[model samples]
Target: MRDFLPADKARRERVLAVIRERYRAHGFDEIETPVMEEYSRLHAGLGGDNEKLSFSILKRGMNAEAIRAAADDPAALTDLGLRYDLTVPLARFYATNRAQLPTVFRAIQMAPVWRAERPQKGRYRQFMQCDIDIIGDASARAEAELMTASLDVLDALGLEGGSIRVNDRRVLDAMLDVFGFVVEERPGVLITIDKLDKIGPSGVVAELRDRGATTGAVDALAAYLDRPSSAPSFDEAGIRAALPTGIPDEVIAHLVALGETVAAARGADAPLVFDPFLVRGMGYYTGTIFELAHPSVDYSLGGGGRYDGMIGRFLGQDVPAVGFSIGFERIVDLLQDAADTGERSVVLVHDRDVPLSTLLALKTALIAQGVRVRVEQRAKNMKALLERSAADGYASFASVGVDTTAESLELRPLN
Candidate 1:
């Protein structure tokens, strides 16, 4: 949805390289999937609102009549859609390649996904997503590993105060049950709950009634929301005391263990916390969910959660999965443009009078010596050419003439 100039593009890649390296260090292997998938799969109610935002691809060989006739029944027209996120396609990929992969597959997907939604500041219809997922692990350890790995990535990027807000879909469900909400209405209720931070308790209650949520359920949740609050903590007693107390002891225990594990792994200054209200938008989430937060931004840096039932939609067998995705576009802007260039990166400024073969020879020699080389013909404004080369990440430059050997050139830093 946007174009990056050379310098901006390079900066983006630098961030991606760090993410890739850190995830690999955590034992996740990188993988790629197509940008499109079967429209049926994308619309299978797993993607939540993203299904509506998907860019559908029309079926091949359709005539005007076919298109017109199928306009109302879109399934008869479009057979594929650009993927809205990496997780769904990953499910298909794992199902197809599971036999060749490790029993517990840890995979990385750093690629662009497309949606048809309206774009806003830092939000685009087409954007890069950096995701790391672990499949076949159902324990709370899986969730802990994911949060720790993501926090480590934030640390590597020098984005301070990056913490994860953790919650469980089951906890949301339980909270709804305790409040006497209808099972059929809980999805819409969850959607409204996700907006609690944006809209206060009175607003949620009013909107729920407007949306026809059960009256009793609305009043019940409203009552809890109005209760005096002590801030939530990542610890067990704190979590119990934070939300409505009856949040299914099993879930509280699970979250406690998950937080403890990540704390032990990341030590003090670890940025993990419990937010009983943190309902990530994706409906496919079957258990724990995460939303990565940074102190400098109002929007989430990125998020993902457990999708234990998603793969079964493809493989016909359940595979436990949880993933963390960094909002690549959002995070890239937070990073300082990399000021350091590789010392071996060099630009060869040559006069037009220099023979092509001689210039080629000089460049070839530097590259053979492990230098990043570029050959630039001298321009009328020598200073501008040198400045541009520096911006393009060339560290030093040397002039070369027809008779110049690689050894005869003296490299000088542009600045």
Candidate 2:
């Protein structure tokens, strides 16, 4: 949906390099999948709202007969859809190649995904997702490592003073149940709650009421949201005390362990926080969910969580997996606005009679020596040419007349 010019593209690549280096340092190996995948896989009820906005590809050639036969159902006419995220495709990839992969796989994926949603300021219909996932390891350590790696990437990018709001799906479910929400309404309720940052408490209450929630339920939910904490901390005991029904001890312990590990590793100034109301929209997230927030930015950098059940759709058995995705597009956008590219180049001005091959050889040699070079015929006014070159990020100029050999070219700095 966007075309990146040289400077913009360079900034994006710089951010990607930082991400790739950080992920590799954390022992994640990269993998790639096709942009399009089976429509059934994309619509597998795991991606939450993303599934609804997926762009499907219609059946073609011989498959067109099926479309004609099943005209009543749009899905029958569509065989594939562009992948909305990397997680689902990774599930399929692992399921297909599980035998070749290690028992515990730490994988990194960087790829563009498509969605058909209406674009907003930072949200795009097509954007890149940079994901690091740990599969086959169900321990709390996996979640901690993922969270730590994500924070480390942000730190590498100089994005400080940001906080990661952590929560557990089980705790959210239990709390919703206590608030008189039924099983069927939990997803809708959680999805709306996920918009708390954008819509605020009053908007949420109105939306809940419009969605058929009772007056008492709405008021109780609002009152609970008012439970004050000076700072975000995982206070399972306080939460359990406030609600009569307690959350599972295992869930509490896992969360506590993750928080402690991250804090100790990151020292006293660690940015991890516990916000009970942080309900990420992905429905497949079975355990922990988190969102990253920064004071300098209005939107989240990125988020992800434990989708222990997603791979089951492919492998027929649950393969515990947890992942975090950095909003690559958004990160690049921020970096581009603030990037100071220390790039310099030399413009090669050659006589009209200079052989094209000779000029090409000079260009290649300069490129090999780590110099950015551009070649053009000699301009009439040398001062004007040098001025133009300097304005366009070139720091120097080189002359290659008909008598000048590739080995005897003279270079002069503009400034």
Candidate 3:
């Protein structure tokens, strides 16, 4: 088990509380799911490239023996894996429980997800994901609300200065089609182009070339993706002026309107940027994609996209959905750096005059008063008790010995 010292636990809980309060204020209902889930539901196309990182389970009876035998073979059982992301499970949940739920469901979930990746500074084999998603809405207003809520949550968490970058998949798809790339190969192409930030323009070109994209298509894509965010603004007029050789004017108008709506939502305090190259990695995302990043962090703190078709795979009917997830562990690490170090006082008690029940009652009362309390166990004398409390980071102590009265207890502060 991972050991979380008292100080660390306190800090984590503080951050979590802020997140919960902000999400709750926005009308999102909290929901939870089991840590373990059947493998096939999680391993389907839902998880994207991270699907291989899932941790699977074993069953009992003949099935258990079969799983054990398959474990020996190494390649026999791949269906029973742990949930890789919360959105897929939420999609499954809505499909199964839709009849009992409202036409529009807004929910928040905070839980630990297991990933078998090599651990690093901020990356762990196990971590928590705090997510919010809205289902059954096709309007861009739902997308706008999600983005606003995400920014509010981060701001409430004390990330005073940051950016929530936004982009639409349709815009990028139009750009690709303009450059003569076939629609069937666009997903793979977008995946490679999304790596442009990690690998430079030349690297992206090389990858696209390796994937059988024509030189002309690769060159145009590289130029478009590499353009600076401030290269030029495209209003309706500018969009019409730059229309590709054979594309329809109506398509350009729709793309232009989408951009206008996103731009109008920006405020003076929190600015949104549009990057044509921002392609979220999830294969199921059919519309807009977004990511949150801070100037101090080297990677995205969190991200998500619109996956309107995901539910159709399970429910046999279309349910438009959009979601965003915060990397809970990463946020915790960031908040730890920003947290203030204040004195924490825990009252440690010992003695027989105060029966065990009375001591516990006192502890509970102190807790109700918002005071931290820790009853030291195994200390025989005041000196030992004080020393142990000091070592354990407690600043105060209360003792009830055999000679003490129930109404009058001894209290002391340890230096």
Candidate 4:
């Protein structure tokens, strides 16, 4: 089994507590789905490279010969696979159980998703995704709410000044059309330009040229995408002046509306910055897209966007949806680097003097009273126990001896 020592468990619990509190305060009901699901249902909404990563399974009861035969023929494989993300399964869940839920459904799910990816320092094959989504409305209000709630979650986790970069897909599409690029080539152009922050302008131009875009087109795209953060904000006349050639004024008006909505929703605490270059990696995003990044971190901590058509593939009907997922593992890694000293403590009772039942009861009571307690497993003297607790970074410890009373247990504050 993977090891989760006392300190690690404590830190994870603290982060989860903050996440749950912030989501619930915004009226999101907590729901959970099974980790494994039928492969068809899991893959129905996901497209492109996402389908290849699904971990499919076969029934265990099948005979060896039959299993071998099925394995040889891809069509004979069964339907089960591990869920890659929470939103797709949740969409299926809502469609199947719509009658039971309210017209407008808001849910917050915290669960692990499996991926067949190479493990690195902060990347894991199995990691938790903290997701929140709103369904049944196509209003900008839903988008604003999701963004506001996301800001609250990150702020509650101590990332107060982080930036939430946002951009509209319509704006990007209009720009591509104005630059004489076909609609079919938009994805390639977007994916390449999305990496501009990681790879510089020269690299993006090289990638565009390699993707069959002409040299002139590549130069224009590079200059457009390379607009620095210091570029001046557009006033009414300036916005009209910056409109792409041949695009309708109505489309530009819609883009202006989206920008105004986002700016108005942003509070004084966490300012929302308009990022024309922000395009999420997912192929399903059909509308406003966003990514959250810390000032000091090079990679995005989390991101999500509107995918109104993704769920329609399964239900065979349109459903309006928008979601944001927090990268819990990445956040944990960043927190490890920036973690300040915490004040919580756990007391370990000697197994010999304190029976397991009594120790559990004490723990439950203390927990109810807002005290964090951990029962000691290793056999050691009081001095060793105290030293171990201190080394684990605890601020205090409780000592339960044979002669200790319920009302007057010894409490030791660590140095």
Candidate 5:
């Protein structure tokens, strides 16, 4: 969907390398899945709105009459669709490869997913997703490890002022139930609450009422929303203080334990926040959910959560899973440009009169000595040529005469 120039590609690869290294260090093995999957699977209800945005691949060998016959159901004409996100593919992958994988698998998937999104700042039709997932473990440890490794990525990128906002879908369910909302209204209520950041508390309440939600439930939630957001802390007290009483003890305890586990690794210094209204958009998230936040951005850098039921849909058996994905496009820009890489690479500026054999020999000799060598015929404007080389990340350049040996070349560092 886009073209990355040499310099752009280099920077991207450098950043990806750092992410892969950190994930691998945490014992997650990288995995790859195809860019396209069966159309029916992509349309499964798990993807939320992303399903509608998927790019479908029409079935081959369909005659004109066949295409027309299926016009009423355009989707029937398609056999596959480009993946809208990595999680779905990861689910299918585990389902098919479970026997070859460990009982508890930590997998890394760094790849591009396609969508038909109206491209915007930080949003693209095609972009890289850096995900680390743990499947087959349903405990808080799975969520904590995800949070820990995600935070570690931000730290490695030299990104500061980052924090993780935590919440549980069960907590929302408890809130709705406590407020007297019926099960049928849960999804409608969540869609409104998820807009709290955009519409604010009063707006969310007003919108719910406009949508003809139950009056008593709306009032109850309004009162709770009006309460002071000043939390006690990120511990059990904090979790309870943020939510009303009657929340299942296990939900509260699990969230508290997750915070404690991550804190133990990152210390109390860990930047974790408890946001009761945090609703990740994916319909498949069955339990704990969270997003990566930085002070500098209004949107989450990335987010993930527990989808303990998703793998079951694929494998026909329950496999607990949790994952975190870094917003590669968003965070890549946030990171300072990579440090200059000129030292290890060199440009050989040669006269046009130099023999091709001489140029190849010189290039080979420098490459053997662990340098990236590029032979360029000297342009009329030597300064322009040197500047171009520097822009390409060459650290220095040396002029190569026909008679000059690799050792005799004098290297001059580029400006």
Candidate 6:
């Protein structure tokens, strides 16, 4: 839905380059998937709310009219949709190609995804997701490695002042049980809770009540939200004690161990915190989930977690998988905000009397000598044209007069 100008494009490419190098160094191989995927697969209850926002493609060919006749029934008219994210399509790709791929696959996916939703400040209907995933690894080490690589990318981009909020689905399930929330109502409850940061506590309580949550459950949640930690690192013991006493020991152990391991892997001054209420909206996440948030922004930069059963739905057997995605658009916005707009490029200006061949020869020589050069006949007043070209990223200017020879091409730096 947007076109990137030259400076914007350059900034985006710079961030992507950093991501690619970091992913490669971590032993991940790049892969791409079609932007369009079958609508059935996308809406198979995998993508959560993203499924509702998918842009579906209408049926085409000889039966197009027949399909349109049933436009009232959208299912009959559409069979494909623009992919909403990179994860599900990745699941399908791995399911189809697992036999040929290595038993342990480290994959990289950097591409744009489409969603039919209202655009916000940093949220776009079309934006790129840079993901790094490991399939076939069931251990917490996979999660640790993903955290390490993702954090390294943030560091490389000089994106400081952020914290990684970590939590597990099992912990959420245990807490819901303690509050007497039924299994069927947990998803809806989580969805409402995920919006707590956007709409305040009052909004979530209203939505949960509307969804038929018991008054007692809402009261308990309100009491819990009253004491949010002021510091970035959350209190682990405080969080654990909030759950039921008989909750599975493995749940606590897994969270504690992953926290310790990821912190160690992240090295000195690691920024990891435990947030019991960090409920990611995606239904596909089966285990650990984390979100990256900056103190200055109300939104998350990006997040991902273990979708152990997502691939199983396709391959008929589970494949342990974990991933993390950096918010490509948000990062670009930050970089652009801090960018210097000064131009370092050169341009060649000529008049109608100047032969086209002469301008071409001059441009070719400058390019051969390793210069970023642009050539154009005079467009407007010389001063206005030069000023406009400078704003468009041209730093130096050259002019060819009637008596000027190729050997005497003089260059002058534009102020």
**Best prediction by TM-score:** 5
Worst 10-residue lDDT window for candidate 2 reads 235-244
Worst 10 residues of 4 by lDDT: 229-238
**Models, CA RMSD each:** 1.9, 3.1, 4.4, 3.7, 1.4, 3.1
State how far residue 85 of model 5 sits from its true place (Å): 0.7
* CA-lDDT, candidates in order: 0.88, 0.83, 0.73, 0.73, 0.90, 0.82
Q: Write the per-residue lDDT of candidate 6 for residues 299-347, one digit (tens) a residue.
A: 7788899999999999999889998998889877877754434434677
- Between candidates 4 and 5, the one scoring higher on TM-score is 5
Between 1 and 5, whose lDDT is larger?
Answer: 5
Q: Higher-lDDT candidate among 2 and 4? A: 2
TM per prediction: 0.94, 0.88, 0.81, 0.85, 0.97, 0.87
lDDT tens digits, residue span 18-54, model 4: 8888988988999988898777776664655666777
lDDT of 2 by residue, 1-415 (tens): 6787655666778789999999999899999899999988888788878888899887786466666798887678888999999999999999999999999999999988888878787778888889999999998889889888888898889886767888889888878877778777777888789789889888898899999876676788988777764554555554445443556788778887887778777886667777778887777899999887788887788998999998998999989999999988877777766534566578999889998888888898889888899887887897887776665557678888777765787788877
The TM-score that candidate 2 achieves is 0.88
Off by over 4 Å in 5: 341-343
Model 2 spans > 4 angstroms off: 62-66, 234-245, 340-344, 353-361, 380-396, 399-415
Q: Assess the local accuracy of residue 109 in candidate 5 as a C-alpha lDDT between 0 and 100.
A: 97
Candidate 4 Cα outliers beyond 4 Å, as residue runs: 68-75, 223-243, 246-265, 268-270, 337-384, 390-395, 398-403, 406-408
Which scores greater on lDDT, model 3 or model 5? 5
Candidate 5 local lDDT, residue 38? 92
Error of 1 at 257 (Å): 1.1
